[model samples]
Every structure is written in structure tokens, then in C-alpha cells.
Target: MSDARQYFDLPSPFAMKRGGSLQGARIAYETWGSLNAAQDNAVLILTGLSPSAHAASNAEDPSHGWWEGMLGPGKAIDTRRWFVICVNSLGSDKGSTCPASLDPATGETYRLNFPDLSLEDVANAAQALVKSLGIEQLACLIGCSMGGMSALGYMVLHPGGVRTHISVDTAPQAQPFAIAIRSLQREAIRLDPSWHGGQYGDQSYPDIGMSIARKLGVITYRSAMEWNGRFARIRLDPEQREEQPFGFEFQVESYLESHARRFVRTFDPNSYLYLSRASDWFDMAEYGNGNVMEGLQRIRVEQALVIGVSTDILFPLEQQEQIAEGLQAAGAKVEFVALDSPQGHDAFLVDIENYSRAIGGFLARI
Candidate 1:
């Protein structure tokens, strides 16, 4: 693992949040710029559900990550000024040790046998990586969607480690509405005949179920206004599917299919199950013994910024507002920015300029 600068092995026998420990546990991460002599210029970026450690173009990999529009030398979270590090989540299929990883004890993929995981585990793993890098304090920790939850978890878990926290399009806890959607996504994957209790082996996978789930996710990630504006009633040519109902004619169906196909090809089905469930299981209030403010109060960060998009129904402006209020109530300096955009929950990734402005300005102050 040391041979590959992209991967880091946590000093082995890493303990998980639920129980049990992983031997030879490894984390995949990408770094930009240089860590200063004091190691105080580090910025940790936690990704959403599907992004990899490749958060932007760098020397090793020129390809841009999902947040290409916002991260780079001169962009928001500028690598020119801060040593930015992005780590793939612990349970992610992208290069990280996940359900798809080999089980050293049995010489088989962990699959369903992978231990129960949670957002706390995700935060802890990233923290471990930071410590291993010899970073005593972070200039900032940034997250969006699931990453946002991880950022909050970092604050609660290690109160003084991060100097600032930036959360976008996320909440302290997964709302029931969001949980219901994710539960359905998991159900779709489990119901696929090929899943075979997550023991499909080398045979075909649950592509149908995984594809369906991704489609469902696309619907939630994008706003109805944006879909209508982009797709409208546009129909696939009648020659494409003569026997199909007119309802399937919308271009949106084609869009969903294309995106889902891309996702199902690379993502591991079991990893999806674990990570999605982990997101729902995260609840700061529970950590606070039923009071969110209590959990927020535990965070000792110098300041925080929360950004919300108006069209994000999955995690709406109200949720971000509450996060800011909780932080304020906890006596932590906080700033909440509500943005109006058509991208819904995905605005942070797609509508880059808005996020760049808010983030860049905030980082400047920090």
C-alpha cells in the first residue's frame, strides 16, 4: 500500500463503529497541492454516495471528479492555497476497502459478511487517515449529501481536530422521507433474483435491481423543474419500441437508463446496500440522547457554514436552517446560505458557481 501513494493502510486491525475489526484495512485518497510545514493548511473533503477519491484534476490523475466544476487550483476549495485531501468513503466500491474487498480471514470477498457500518465509521476512517498523514489540525472539512453527515460526525467525534466545517445539501440526520426513498432503493437491489442473498459470485449481478434503484435516485437527485425543462414531453422515436406504451416515450426514461447503466457497471451491489443503510442509520439526535443541540454542542470547531438549495426536497432548506440554528444554539459560530437553483439536492455538484462563491468566500475568512 505504501508503494501506491493513492492508497493508505490504517495501522492494521482497524476497529469499526459497530463491532469487529478489519485487518489490512486500506483507504483510497487523492491529494492536491502541498501540505505546509506546520501541516495546518490541510482541507479534507468527504464525498457523497457515489464519488471516488478523485475529486479533481491532479498530477497523478488528470481526470476530473464529480465536483470538477468546483475543485481545482483556482476554484472553490482551491488547491493552490490549501492541501486538499479527498478520501473515498469506507464502504464505497471505488478503490476503498468495502464489502467488495477480499476477506483476509476466508480469502473470499466480504460481501454480506462485511461488518455493519455507519457514518461514524466513515468519519473515523477519514480521521485516521488524517492522523496518519501527520495533520494535527484541518483548515476545513467539507462535505455534501452523505458527506455532509460525515462532516458533522467529524465535529462530534473529534471536537478540536477541524478548524472549520462546511456542509452542503445535507442534514444532521436522514429524514424519514429520505429514509423511505433509500429503503426502497435497497429493497429493489435485494429483490433482484440474481442477488441470491448477495452471493451471486462470479455469475451475473443484480443489474436490474441496481439500475432501478439508480433511476429512483436520479429522480430524487434532480428537481422536477429541472427535469421538465431538460426533457419535457420529448419522446423517443416510435421506431425504437413499437410495442411500448406512449408513457415510456419521455426522454427522461432514456436519461435514467443511461445513468443507471453507467453506475451499475462499476458499483458493487452489496456496497450500495451497506452505504445506503448506513446513511439512514445516522442520527445526531440519537447521539445527543434525543436532543440535536446537545450533539451540536459537542463540536468544538471554530466556525461552520451550511449551504442549502431551495429545490432540494430530499434535504430541504429547512434542514440546513435547523443545522445552523443548532450550531448557533450550541454556541458555535455558524453561517447558513440558502441558494435558489434548479438542481435540487445535486446543486452542489452541478451548479458549481453558486457553491464556489459561498465556499470560496467562507474559506477566505477562515
Candidate 2:
């Protein structure tokens, strides 16, 4: 298959938010559909922590993408009507300048040496890419999961850059519960001897650490209801079960193990560490006298759709209501949808029909 990924070279000596600078940095992105002569129909999608720029399939890369069900010729984010651009987060492993990427100054991977990353930096990089494409203002800005926080940063730092917004399951700040979970996840990775302070080689990769961290993430990504519904107390087949004590005896354990195995090798551990911390560090309150609602009110948009799954413990529905209320206070027409999806934080990805209906309806009116 042809590669659909494209690169945007950031201005040399890109300054990071928490001090330190990067030279020869680049961002990876992908585009679909056509830009109108007016350039006003552009829609930018800021993705969650782990997704690449390929949100949907195109002729160049025909394989289904992470958001393939929601974006297409006539899907919710219709490529036929809007020029869609999806950008890989700067610190992500996916074809972007990240911890695994070589440092041009030292000719070695940055690894732990990579400068501190923030969602603001992610927003800035995305804005720079949009400006490079000559889009003065976006018709709609869509952000899902962690991306919603990044989108808020983008709107705050560059007011009036987007005419409208879509906030999916995300929070304005990392709550205490979320911070604790992530802290444990990071601790699990660091406690593994093979991690070696982010210096482990492929042969000595932190497989067990990464697996445990991924399993933790997976546990939080969905809900207890979904788990009970899908697997319940189902035991593994006798033949499939490990023939050792304290081995895989339950279907849920096997499911998490399979997911972790698939992810641990593909993603760079250092990149995961960096991005996870960034997610933890993001707090909109810093921009509004330590108030999240006031910080959200700083963004300027004509309209917005704030969505959340009722079962999402990671980013609860109350957070979505806060976004709606704040944006409305900022004079933007806001629509808040609280979905009772058993899928939890991942409802936007799994419960596509509900998401599509809300997103498509909102976009249609815009």
C-alpha cells in the first residue's frame, strides 16, 4: 500500500514550553478531500494519545484507519464536504518528532533526554501545520479523548482560529483519580529492571513493564459493565490455559494480555512515558486564575458540541457538562450529549452510531 503520511518541517529551533529547544523537528500529518477556494471548509482533527495521523482510509492508503467508521465520503466527518486534516501529536511514536526520533544535534535518539512535552506544544505544532496549509481559520476543530484537551489549548493560544469545536470524551484537567492511575502506570514501567532509565535496547526491551502499563491503560479505557457483559467470569479453555500456577485462568486476563502483547512492541516505551506525562500535566486552569471553567471560557468559537459517555470513569460526563457550560458562557452556542454507553471512555470509538449522529448533526447545522 502507498504511504499516505506527510511531513511538515517545523521552524528550526522550535522552542518547547518547559524550556529547551529542538532543531530540525518535523510533524507527521495526513489529509483527505479538497480544500475549497475559500479555504474556510477546513476541519482539523486532533487525535488522542496513541493514534497516528491516519484517521481514515484514502486512495493512497486503502487500509481502514482508527476512525474509519466515522470519517469518509459521507460519514460523520465527511471528506466530500470538508477538507480533513489529522496530525500526529509531536511526542507520539507515529512518524512524528518524538523521543525515539534521532536528535539532530547529537546524532542519537533523544530518549529520556527529550525536552518536556505538553499538550500546548501539540496544539502549537498543529496550528503551525494548519497555517502552512494556508487555512486562516478552521470551519470545525474536532478533538477526542486527550486531543480535546489539546484542542482547548489550541483555541486558547490562538483565539478565533476555529469557528466551531467538537469536544469528545476528555477533561479540562487531569483529575486526581486520573493522575493516580497514570502515576501507577508510570511506576510500573520504571520498576521493571529492563526499562533501564529509558535506555533499554530492543533485545532488553521492557516487555513486562510495557505489558503491565498497557494492561492498566486497557482496564481504564473501558468500563466494568462492558467487561462483565463481554467476558463475565468466563474461564479460559483448559487447553488454552497456562499449565502453571497463578497463570491465565480467566478470559479477561487473556484479553488484556493479547492487547498488551500487540502494543508493547509497536510503540516506543520512552515516547509512551513522555506523552503519558504530558496528559497528566495539562491543566486549563493555569490560563484562568486556577479555574477550569474560566479557562475554557477563554476560547472563542461560534458553536461547540461537547460529548461524553456516562460510563467513562477516565473522563466523566460531568467534565463534558463543564465544557458545555463554559463554552456557552463564552458566548458560543453549545450542545452537550451524555451517552449511556457501556463501553466507557472508548465509547466514541466503539459506539460509532451515536457519535456519528451527534457529530454529523452538529456539523450539518454549522
**Which candidate leads the pack in lDDT?**
2
Clash tally for model 1: 0
lDDT of 2 by residue, 1-366 (tens): 123789999988989999888899999999998899999999999999889999988988888899999999999998889999999999998999999999999999999999999999999999999999999999999999999999999999999799999999999999999999888888888888999999999889889988999999999999999999899999999998998899999999999999999999888988988888999999989999999989988989999999999999999899899989999999999999999989999999999999999999999999
Query: Quick one: best TM-score, which candidate?
Result: 2
List model 1 lDDT by residue over 270-316, tens digit each.
99999999999988897688977677666777788989999998998
Q: What is the number of residue pairs that collide in model 2?
A: 0
Would you list the clashing residue pairs of candidate 1? none
After superposition, the stretches of candidate 1 with alpha carbons farther than 4 Å from their true spots are 1-5, 239-247
| Residue pairs with clashing backbones, model 2 | none
TM-score of candidate 1 versus the correct structure, residues matched by position:
0.96
